[model samples]
Target chain A: MASVTFDHVVKRYTSDLTVVKDFNVEVADKEFMVLVGPSGCGKSTALRMLAGLESISEGQIRIGDRVINNIAAKDRDIAMVFQSYALYPHMSVYDNMAFPLQMQHMKKAEIDKRVKSASSSLGLGNFLDRKPRALSGGQRQRVALGRAIVRNPQVFLLDEPLSNLDAKLRAQTRIELQKLHRDLGTTFIYVTHDQVEAMTMGDRIAIMNAGILQQVGTPGDIYDHPANIFVAGFVGTPTMNFVAATVQDGVATASGFHVKLPKALPAAKGILGFRPEAVTDRIPDPDSAMEMKVDVVERLGSDQFLYGKVGGDSVTARVDPRIKVEPGDSIKLGLDTRTLHFFDSETELALL
Target chain B: MSVVSPATKPGSPATKPVNLERRSLLSAIRPSRAILNIVLVVSAVFWLVPTIGLAIISLRPESLFQQSGWWTALTAPSQLTLSNYQTLFAQGLVARGVLDSLITSLEITVPATLLVTIISSLTAYSLVFGRWPGRSVVFLVIVGLLVVPIQVALIPVVQEYRVFGDLSGFNPFGTIPGVVIFHVAFGLPFGIFLMYNFYSGIPKEMLEAGRIDGAGEWQLFRRVALPLGLPAAASLMIFQFIWVWNDLLVALIFLGNNKHATLTIFLFEQTRTLAANYWIISTGAMISIFIPLIVFFSFQRYFVRGVLAGAVK
Candidate 1:
């Protein structure tokens, strides 16, 4: 197992079309570093460049102590599981897993031992003789994983490997992948557009937007303190609500409410950000609470969500499922002031 | 109809009994299906008539073949014998020519088909997956070559062969290898065109997966792209095999009617000089048809519908 480092990496397709700019990350040994972003955000491009599948336009990537920019993909000694579980359809599962070993010209007995152990670990022991077409989607995904695991390379790269599975399978595979990572203790560079996967899986998540690195932190760190407005909005479910507000003296004012800041800020205009959970149905202090005119209520059995308007701006709130609420009902909700965030309107960078 | 109509409604107590009776009635006399089957059989028989006629003519005695049409022997079954086949085989020189022609055809067709399939597959793999510069331009040139007629290149290629002989001390003008080379040249454009389109359909992720699995370029082509391209390769072999096998023009021009004549050239020579050598012509045609028929039928299984199913989600 080895740590991976991308130092000042840039992926410029053409003079005017640079996709990833000055990408830099230092993944520690045995770290599960996830690169997450929306489509066209160049997260996958960064992973591809590190994989050596794509040529880096500038800078250097090193695995352990070896610089890899001039190396071929096969020579890089990294295995990648594609978003498409690209199992060799003509070969049986055994051969699929044994392919890398065969390429290494390893002894036959050792290859068999590795393939058998990997297949069994993947719960694919019975499927060793079956072709890829005979396996289900989840099984095919496991075979892809098995193929990588058999190689036992210094690092494992997975590009949205669980995206092809059904929802239930995706959930199950996500946990299994985490367990596999723990078992292997290999440095893994995983890329995905799904924030939930990032939050649940990564030892550290690096969020990117428009080819620029937004933030790199532990999931809890990122969730509690996103560096910019984009990370704040993109990292959360139901997303963080951003309300345009103006600060005067120590008070911040918006359309339907005003709150006193803990400390005074020089910025006259800023955006207030808060998670849905921070807006609760019970108001701890009526004076600080704002009235939300509920437009739609979704009861998800365990947790209910209220989508509504607060002073002509849309807001979503996570509320108690037992509480009886309906659309067009006006309700009072409290903001957890300590959990609230503020970003400058001009820079969109976090102010607190 | 009346009974079935009442059962069409939901929760009707009469549904099951009427459904079973209607199904049995429909099965007993399905007129539309019957008409479709009859039409299919008629078309199949219409396709087979010429082949069956050739078979019968090949079986008829040479005297009877000249005296009457094959239909006459079909009615009088006793007159239809294997005598024509026997006579053609019994003539020592004719037998030698047939044997030599068969060998020559095999020598030309097998290499040509194998070379075209292998070269086209490799070229298509590179075109689709290789990261080299000018790949698109090279592919476009190959596709452009598809439109240049083989007839146009015939004279120029023969002159070029003579020039090559002058420079290299080896002329390809009237040899088996000469015919094989010509066939491979003319066959490659379409072969690459077909295989390139097919290879393009294979998910790019598949090749990427191979690369990450530590496969080099040659390994990727051999282990991933080639296996996935089997259906296209199989069909290409069948096409190139039949085209070179039955080619009279290329063989006649490049491999002149000396000793190294292909089956088609030999058959053509029989009909060209001895116009009345119907027995030899019919028998030789059947022999030539026999090889390609075996080839097509043997490799027909590779024309499988979903070879790439479940390759990717």
Candidate 2:
């Protein structure tokens, strides 16, 4: 078992540009750690640095007790599933899976046993003799996974491993990956830009933005309590609604709606943040009901989303699908004040 | 091998979309295509007639070879005999010397082809994947070297070989090794150019994947880069082999009057003699043609693409 530590890791390309700025994260042993962010956000760079495919410009990264800064990629005792899969074309599926084991100078019987077991586990037993070119995309991806798992390395680094898969396969693989983490009991450092993968797969998610670590917390912690405006806006679908508001005496008021805050932070002007699901059709708190000028209404069987204007700020509300609402309707929706997050307008940091 | 089903198939293209390609062979032969086929066949026949004539002449007796055209033997089959070849065999110096030249040609060509191929592939691999500084600059320098013709390097290289011999006491002149060295040197830049361009198209991720699999740099080259580079390397080998096999200038300038006279020099010597030995020239020409033909045919099967089709998304 190995836990990876990145101490003040900085990836600077030049004097003027730095990709990962003083990043620090300690993944516990056997923990499923995900680095999630937008494109060009240096999440992949951080993972690459950990995988020894990239060099750390400053500071150090340690796996278990060893500082792996100078270690060659082959000696890092780690396996990675790339976005492109990168299967060896000349090798058969069986050979591809056994390549690393053979590279270790393993005995033929041991190599065969591991390769057969890994390929069978990956459901690639039937296609073991086929070259990579003859297989489908999903099959080739499984061969890549089979190759990585066959070695049973100390750590697994998956860089958007499911990105090349279709949507249905990605969802299926996400569950299998979590199960894999459980079975292997190895530290998994997964990097992806897809928030749903982060939320559904990672045991602990480290959200990064613009080369800086934004927040490190469990899915529930990140979902319920975002660290700042960026995390709030990035983590959820239909996005969180942000309203420029004035906070005074524990009361936050926007253009048309006003809500009472639980506790007041030391800020006069702040941004009010709330997820789409927080606004409901049922009026739980009639006192906090606000008027919404609905511009578009979407019914998705399970939920209904209303995209509209609550005064000058546009907001989206997820309500009971049974509730009938349409465009150009002026509706009264209840905002759960308990779920509200107040961010300091100047700093964009969450206040409550 | 193709999706074009026979007309008898249940799911033939006739059921839908009016496919023209699946029509009967007779109908498929359009006027334009027929004309194209005829033109191609005629051109091919025209191109091969000289080699056919040489083969016939090589089989004929010297008396028949001098008296009649080679085409006359096509109708008079009895006139063709192996006596000329027998006479060639009987003449020990001429026949043994020709065979020796053939052996010498192989020695020069094989090593030149092999050395150029291996060194060029290694150099190209370094230029493409080695993380050192000035890689593109180095590649550009090699590309610049490609424009330099062997004619320009002939005198300087000969002088350099002398200097090398004077310093080392193993002067390259009067030996086939000297000719091989020249061919390998001139073949390298083009060989590297072809290989570098080819290796550039391979996905860099495959090599990175190799590294992650605990493969050392040499293993990555041997296992990944080398296998994927076969087609380019094969063609480079064939080109180098044929070019060296047919070369006269470098052999004459470097390996002059040596025991290992190459086939090209042997043919040149045939013409230099006062009698102008047509028999040796034609017979030797046939041997020279056959060597490259066999080489080309043997290597052509490896020029396959799509080996990397599913290696990545």
Q: Give me the runs in candidate 1 sitting further than 4 Å from their true place.
A: B1-35, B92-96
- Counting clashing residue pairs in each candidate, in order, gives 0, 0
| DockQ list for all candidates | 0.78, 0.75
What digit string (tens of lDDT, one per residue) describes model 1 on residues A226-296?
99999999988989988988888877788777767766688589998889998888776666688899989
Report every candidate's CA lDDT: 0.89, 0.89
Candidate 1 per-residue C-alpha lDDT over B1-313 given as tens digits, one digit per residue, 9 for 90 to 100: 2224554557756457766687657765677678899999999999988888888888887778667888887679998777776766665445338777888889999999999999999999999999999999999999999999889999999899999999999998887788888999999999999999999999988888888778889999988899889999999999999998989898888877457577888888887784578778888889899999999999999999898988888
In candidate 2, stretches whose alpha carbon ends up further than 4 angstroms from where it belongs are: B1-32, B89-96, B274-276
In order, the interface RMSDs are 0.9, 0.7
RMSD over all Cα atoms, model 1 = 3.0
Docking class of 1: medium
